[model samples]
Structures are given as C-alpha cells and as structure tokens.
Target: MDFARLTGLIAATYTPLNERAQLKTDVVPAMVDHLIQQGLRGLYVCGSTGEGMSLSSADRKAVTESYVQAAAGRVPVIVQVGHNSLDEARELAAHAAQCGAEMISATCPSYFKVTSVDALVDSMQVIASGAPELPFYYYHIPALTGSAIDMPEFLQLAGKRIPNLVGIKYTAPTLFEFQMCQSVDGGRFDIVWGCDEMLLGAYATGAQAGIGSTYNVAPALYRNLVDAIEQQKWDEARRLQLVSIEMIRTIGRYPFHPAMRCVLGFQGFDVGDCLLPQPKLSEQQAEQLRSDLQSIGFFDWAL
Candidate 1:
C-alpha cells in the first residue's frame, strides 16, 4: 500500500460525556469543527486522550462513527482500537474501516504484557488483519501499555508479517530509539511524534508529524513552533516550546485529563468531565486552573 504519510499536528481527541458520564456524541460535530478551525490537521479518535480503554466496545465504535462522520473527509480520522481482547480489537478495527476511517491503530494488549518482538508482531497482526485494506500504525506508548518491545526491531519484523503496517505512533521520550525506528527499512515507516511538550526536540530529530492531546487546545502555539522551525528561527522555536512546557506543567498540577476537560470548558466546548478512576475538578480547582493558565498567558497564545 502506498501510504500518504501523516504530516502536521493531529489531535488526540477527547470523548464528550454527559453529567451521568454516558456518551454525549451530539457534541462530536462541534468538536470536530472546532479542532479544524483551530488549524489541527487530523483527528485521532478513541486514543488515551479520548479515554478509549475506559469506554465500552460499543461506545468506542459509536465514537469512531461519530468522529468519522463529523470529519466527512475534511481530515483523516485514525481510530485507536486497542483492547486487551485481540478479538475485540480486531472487531473495532474492522468497524473503523467500515465506518470510513482512513487508518487504524492499536497498542499491544497491556494485561498479558507482550515480552518479545515476535509476540508483539503476532498480536498486532491479529488486529491489523481485520482492516486489511486500510493502513495500520502500532501505538507504541510503553509507559501506558507496559509492552516496551524494541520499536526498530518490531518495525522490521512486523513490516514483513503485516501487509498493511505503515508505521508507529511513537509516544515515549527516547529520541534515540525514536530516531532508530525512523531509520528502519531506510525510513519506510511514518513514525509520528506523540509527546507534545517535546515536539521541538522531535522536529529537530526529523519528525514530520505529531499526534497529541494538547493540540486540541493549543494548536496555534504548536503551529507557530513548527513555523519557526521551518523558517530556521531557533530562538523563537525555543521560546514557543517553553510556553508549551509551562502550560503542560500547569495542567499537570491537577489530574491531567480532567484538567484538560476543564480547559476545554474555558473555551466553551462543554466537553464535560472525565469518567471515574480519573477524577474531575471542583469549581474552586477549575477556577485556580484558570488563574494559573492566565498567569502564563495561555489564553492569549493558546488561540
């Protein structure tokens, strides 16, 4: 398959819920429109940012359908279908393809903890086979998945086994390993950077694209960072990167995803709060978050 590499900023989108924490899919269209208007280049549905692991399989499918329909070919929607059950992951991948998603991605099953490159390849092959016509990207977030298989080796082996395998969503901070993954098969894979705060470093190491949760709220800031890099303005790029670091630090003070929802609320998106196991912010906490962000001029530059 001749895959068109994903370039520019792609948002790891959030799943909206109601007060009861049920799926509030009606908000999806508005969310998609807002992301595109904010200059995001693509949408990554049902990833960590979207609480994919927490949602039921049915809800994941619904969210995939909603995002794909909302995007309507305006931007590519890459559905993250990873599940502990390979069968469920395969089903989700097929459903994403059936619903018209442009690509599919999945993490290795976390519960069993794949310990070998061959095991990782076999596991992903089961998921990618379901969406044989569409491109597949292995979601390599070792911190979350607990499967820290060497990416360069896995890419080389999986490339031969999985016919539609295109590349990886490299999320770890190890730029050395990331660069090695990029060099595999003579740069055949589309290794998209996943860490938003370290995006400048990734660009310095030859990253062509990035998929991150922060891109949802701060696309303009990252766009300017990329622009500075493209224009060879090292000082401006470093300054913009520092702004992202500080912004992430402020959000990190609270439970990350819930605070991200609070930030979205500030922007009038009404995305509601994260589900349990990820706590929601109180009124006072939300106010304090707003103040911290204001102190850093986040509202001014996040646009």
Candidate 2:
C-alpha cells in the first residue's frame, strides 16, 4: 500500500456550484490547495456532501478530472462515483482511475430494496468490472442508503471472489460496527470511518482513515487527531475530540448540505444552495452557523 493509502483524514469535499446550481470546477482546485496546506491526507469528491446525485455524469467527470489534474499528484483524491445506474457508476470508476484518483468508492444503490444481498453485490461487481485494475472501497452507510451490509455481507464481498475489493468506508453509526469489520479481517484491512463525531473511536477501533461531512470546515483538526494518537496523548486527544464532536453536532443538526455550502462561502468558495429537496437553510440558520463559527474563532484568519 502507498503511504497515502495508510491512515489519515479524507475530507468528503463539497462541490462549488454556480448560481444556476451547476458545478463550479474552477472553485474546486483552490479548495484542494487549501486542504493540502492544512495537511489533509486525501479528499473524497462526488460523495453525498458533494451533491453527487444531483450532478450529471458529464459534470461529475469534469469535476473529478479537474481535481485530479489540479492536485498534480500532491495528495490522494478518492472519487465517489456510485449512483442509481450501474453503467454510469462503471463509467465513473474507469474515469476516476484514468484521471489519477488514488482509490474509487461507491455507496449502496438505494432507490430499491431488493430481495437479497446479491442485489448489492451485483452492483459492486458491475462497477469493479468497469475498472478492472483499480482498487475499490465499498461505501457502507445503511442510514443514507437504506441498505445495511452486516458483517456476513461484508465478508462475502472482501473474500477472494471479488478482485480489486481492498476495503470499505463503513459509515455505520457505532464504532462497534467498525470493530466488527476489523475482527473479520484480523484488523489489517483498511476501514475508513465515515462519521466525524465518531472518528477518534473509529480510529481506536482500527479505522485507517476518516471520511466525514464536517471535515469541510475542519480538516486540520482531524489531521491533529491522528497525530495525537501517534504521540499517545490520550487525554489531550480527547479535548480535540470534544471540540470536533461539538462541531459535528452543530452541523449535523441543521439541514447539512446547505449549511455546509454557506460555511464554504465564508471561507471563500462561493457554492450555491443544496439541490432541490436539500434546500439551503433559512437566512436565520445561516446567520446562526455564522455566529457559531465566529464563537469558535473560525474567522481567526482575519484577526
């Protein structure tokens, strides 16, 4: 495994959208640079936070290609290309690999509740076939996808039957679920935690990387968490965890996708509202997040 493949924080970056709600590819490269400056280990583009579902295939490809080129091999960029359509997901997997994405991941296709685990397995197998040589990580989030892959289901996928299946971004709520994945793999497989609030516990339970929504505002905070663990400062690490959990609670409580885009605005990226159904928060909610940010010294750069 590459050093970039080892453990750290991978921010599921938000897309910079235009006033018309189209992806702003220009705004992406700058954020990629900002993340690198803050010491982020990698980035996960086109995931839930990026409004991947709303983006057209061409748009997602453009964004993925642009970031891969702009990164210029500086840091690992993992592209989330899974969607309702298997063909599109396959295309995305191949596109990402061609564009230099370090790893490719896909969430469970959620629109339908199928008869069995084979439904999910078939979706992954199709995507793997699309990118025959690229390494793949399964995106396991039962809440969002309305599909759960218990330990037995996961083991079936990770077995020799599936080539290019190296790990999973287990987005399950509890660290116990992550611990279970570690147990089945003898604690050696890469499991990236998808919950920011649970990241420390996830890491302690053997997660290699953290993939989260709140990371858009606080990549450095998480990068520090990893370092604290390395130094074995358990108590001090808890302080950072407390700070991060508070932020997650604040962000997670609200309509997340939009509130997050607003914060990105203040930070300098000018992305627009969340796609329909994921509407931008009320003006009051925006100000509240802004105030919360100021209270936490998020604007300290101005000082």
Top candidate on lDDT is 1
lDDT of model 2 at position 303: 13
lDDT of 2 by residue, 1-303 (tens): 332354577778887777787777887778888877877777888888887878889989998988888788887788898888989999999999887888888986788753367677777888877776777888887788888657446655545556777678888776786787776656545677888887778778777778777776777777777789878899978988887877766766688778888888777778778878787788898898889877866565321
The true-versus-predicted C-alpha distance at residue 256 of model 2, in Å, is: 1.1
Model 1 scores a TM of: 0.99
Model 1 poorest ten-residue lDDT run: 268-277
4 Cα displacement, candidate 2 (Å): 6.4
lDDT (tens digit, per residue) of candidate 1 on 176-196: 999989999999999999999
Q: What is the lDDT for 224 in model 2? A: 75
TM-scores for all candidates: the values are 0.99, 0.92
Q: Worst 10-residue stretch by lDDT in candidate 2?
A: 1-10
List residue ranges in candidate 2 displaced over 4 A: 1-4, 185-188, 300-303
